[model samples]
Target: MKNRTILLTGGGTAGHVSLNQALIPELKNLGFNVEYIGSKDGIESGLIPDSFPDVPYHAIASGKLRRYFSVKNFTDPVRVGAGLVQALNVIRKTKPVAIFSKGGFVSVPVAMAGKLMSVPVIIHESDVTPGLANKIAMPFANHIFTVFKETLKHVPKEKSTCTGSVIRSELMDGSAAKGKEICNFNNDLPVLMVMGGSQGSAVINEAIRSNLTALLKQYNVIHLCGKGNADSSLMDLANYKQFEYVTHELPHLLHMTDFVVSRAGSNSIFEFLALKKPMLLIPLSKLKSRGDQILNARLFQQQGFAHVVEEEELTPERFLAEMQKLQMDEDLLVDAMTNAESPKTAYEMAKLVAAHTKN
Candidate 1:
């Protein structure tokens, strides 16, 4: 009997899982059984199960692949070895024809296991530069897909394709009316959606909170403040809604937003572009990241799709000023977005991946 199962792996942050989330239904429609391998306690553990209750979720041990010196660096290799064995077991039983990895620390072991098992592995890179995990996993992959054309310079060009971004279809189905209702906002005010990534940013949170009173004078605010970061004191503030994290309701909130203030994660910035939302992007500094977000933000700025505010320069005053500037440049930004390349639909992306599956 031919194997029709497709295994998906990636998770540490929400970005790693979101593309898989978008592709799951499309893969199912194409008659492939989909399953996920992720870290036991990573964000994907909750996201995959909550979003697709029936799909099997396999938990495996994973260690963070950090650049900085850490004591765990010595212990993590053992965990990676264990994860590889666990992944091999899952691949043996499931007999997936192919494994698609979205490139996080958890994905490295899975990719290695897939190579060892002779299952074709496909890896996707969402940034201009390949992340460390993806860099390590690239050799194990049969093919690679990149969201940015510039990424080809960093990966093996012969096996890579720049497929652009793949956006979740549900995002386009949101209603502005539902969005307003979700926020319990009534008065006429431009909406500003603030996202600080899945785990939240203390710098962003502090800047927003300090300037909330001034910001309320101009616009309604919807803050996705990350888990356990919500302030109890601000709970009663009118025209300001704060959520620790939002899943299904995100599209609706985004639909109602007139402007966005967010980190420069490629998946997120591209979604904002697709939605024609003018944005002020505060990318993670080079000290905190490999500078991929900085590159992503710069490209968007060059294209006139967004405005950039470096984290080092961010203050309550600067944040508000940038918000005002984003509003002023809204028309130009929307115009630029209108001319930007459309994202590949999940169905199209699914077909592409399906084409690569072993017959």
Candidate 2:
């Protein structure tokens, strides 16, 4: 186990990249050389190398698995297959001890290639419901790790471990508190952190756009306005901090904020729990992206971790009302954060996979 090489592949969005990022430094800390493989068009291209400047960076043409008709859908698999071949070559050259996957089409190839090369393969499902990529990679993977207890049904009992979803160590490892001066607000006012999960939900932005003034009256907001959505003309905001990408300050903002209005991406949901911040979670609808978010949000709501709402059900009025309700039920917030899963069990998955490689 001394200085073994490990290759990790996942990302088109930050949800996947963040999980990949969470595990890298820790793996390096354990004395493994780490390489990241991601889509050239995805968040990984920027986030991965930046976070681990010294680590090797590789890009593949990968994409989302769309539910409905799109011109781009047909060509995605072909591009992904090419990336898979490329990933296989990288693995052959590195001879990694394990391939860690976090559910991206980019990862599908990496996981498969690892299995084919007789290297260990471990896949971590960040959602309560597994993604299509995970579904495809499950059979080849030697072990599975997940954030939720429910994901076990989708994975073999022998191979699956509930380690929670691994958030970046910089994030959930009791390091969430930080410089209050950067936020520029008193400890009295509530801070609402709004996240759209890597792409910045247009619908969430619309809701906030319609009520920025109302939001400012009660709370200070730090909004992660995905790549192109930070339109200042939408509504003049006071006490609002906007970022196209805030790769570094996620945990600090989570700690500083009293509440959140967020998309219920599995990774995001787990972070809210880790921080014990009450959330008004809006799951993208059933018709959206294989309904993974909808499935994930329902599971979290069932566990009483967050109050779930659909984007269609969210309005400025609804958000304000939910805020009032959450403000009243302050006790529930603390109770919900005592969740069963954790994000640090990636080490457990690694050990299991490494064992399989021996066999």
lDDT of 2 by residue, 1-359 (tens): 66578888888777877766766766766667888888887778888888889989988767667667899898888886887788888987887877888777778877777878888888878787788888888999888887778878877899788766555556654333462555555546778888887878888887876888888888888888788887766434457777766767676777787888888888777777777788878888876677788888887777777787788788789978887887776577668666445446545444444554432
Using lDDT as the measure, the top candidate is 1
lDDT of each: 0.94, 0.76
Show model 2 residue runs off by greater than 4 Å: 1-3, 71-74, 172-179, 233-238, 339-359
The per-candidate count of clashes, in order, stands at 0, 3
Off by over 4 Å in 1: 1-3
Clash pairs detected, candidate 2: 164-342, 165-343, 166-343
**For each candidate, what TM-score against the reference?**
0.99, 0.90
Candidate that would win on TM-score: 1
Q: Once model 2 is optimally superposed onto the true structure by TM-score, how far is the C-alpha of residue 148 displaced, in angstroms?
A: 1.3
